[model samples]
Target: MGEFAKRHQSPWPIIVCFALNFSKVVALLSPIDFLFYLFAGFTLAAGVGVITARNPVYSVFFLIAAFLNAAALFLLAGAEFLAFILIIVYLGAVAVLFLFVVMMLDINLATVRAGFVRYLPIAAVVGGIFAAQLIIMLLIWQQSETPPTLNALGNSPMNQPNNVYALGRVLYTDYFVAFQTAGIILLIAMIGAIVLTLRPRAGIKTQVISQQVSRKSSQSVRLVDLKLGQTHPTTAATAPTEPQEGSA
Candidate 1:
């Protein structure tokens, strides 16, 4: 309690949270947990910096830091599988791929800035809609102070008749056909839309009506007349090759 009191005065209690959790490592309060909390805050700050950086390369670095911090938080929450997955899938793999792609893609700031004036109106409308949605969500959320928690009921309808797993079970199993049908409908609509907008572009290879109409078999082929002339033979290896032994 004294350690916490000292921490509260500094306006930074992450170290306190880390120390409190770390002290429980030996089946008791782990003192080192305060460090993890502090680290998590730094990671979040780095992630924000990365997103705001003008250079895509710097942003990728910040993204990596954020994923690492998120994984740390997951571990603190007792989710080892999720924590490792977050690090491996996001930090180890996806971040590197994004870094490589960003490095390769050439982005001209001048070209991008040129379109700002023309797109300002559309951008403003979209931004306004997003702001409105955010305000509505915040207002609805602020109406309640208590944090949401799931009731661990065994006989939940989302699961089996008397079981409780997750709401996803019925969604994936019972509604899988609907999902597939929706996918096929989207595919057909996409194909139809593509066909609707297709235009025969100029200078493309195609059969010409004029060429076909003017074509004639006689013009395409001719039998050339040649005068018969006697010519001396060069040489003969075997006039008629020794007759294959009596095979007349």
Candidate 2:
């Protein structure tokens, strides 16, 4: 037995073979499952790339790739409505916005990373706490008696009229208050973001709405009476000239 154990020290090779064979079998059994795994792999890889990339633009691209993969996963999971919304709202709008912002910003990587070491401990602690909470929640969910259902109408998701209808019913009926609260929170966040990034710079011309609204026609327009053939000289042209020493 000792000799046999020495000959095969680890079962990793067998485990790897089994895992590959299992995945192949699942892929063959259900194409959707295969697509789900493919998208999941893409999402995971892109998510890692987002954090690891040196260039902010590359990071934003990776994040958009991750969002696209996530949308694919959502589609494979039969949440077509959510998949489309995720693609449209996140990848189409939010990711593009992030990309534009990253491209436009004059980011100094060295300056941004200067305090990385100082904040590393706190960031690590927060990340660990978040990971732990996710693990605990997942474990609790796995052990729960009720199988996960997307339906909020007391019917199984399979029996729902449609994905959009089901989601709307849930959002408006069971989670209405929560939905409104989330909207309000999002609105506040949007306002806060606008306020934080907005700065008044010298020499930048901006329209003052109050000044515009309060202005009279006389301030903007001057009716000048001139002779038929005479041209009106501008202030610069009509200004009294300082005579040079050599001139009259």
User: RMSD, each candidate, Å?
Assistant: 14.1, 10.5
Per-prediction TM-score to the true structure, in the order listed: 0.39, 0.68
Q: Compared with the true structure, what per-residue lDDT tens digits does model 1 show for residues 1-248?
A: 12432344443344455456744533432344454546667787987787477777887888888888888776554455667878998877889899998889986656866898899999999989999999899678637443122233332232233222333344356566887799899899989989999987988898799977996645443333444773323113333323223221
Name the lDDT value of residue 166 in candidate 1.
38
What lDDT score is found at residue 225 in candidate 2? 65
TM-score between candidate 2 and the true structure: 0.68
C-alpha local distance difference test of each model: 0.62, 0.73
Candidate 1 runs further than 4 Å off: 1-33, 109-248
After TM-score superposition, the amount by which residue 162's alpha carbon in candidate 1 deviates from its true location, in angstroms, is: 24
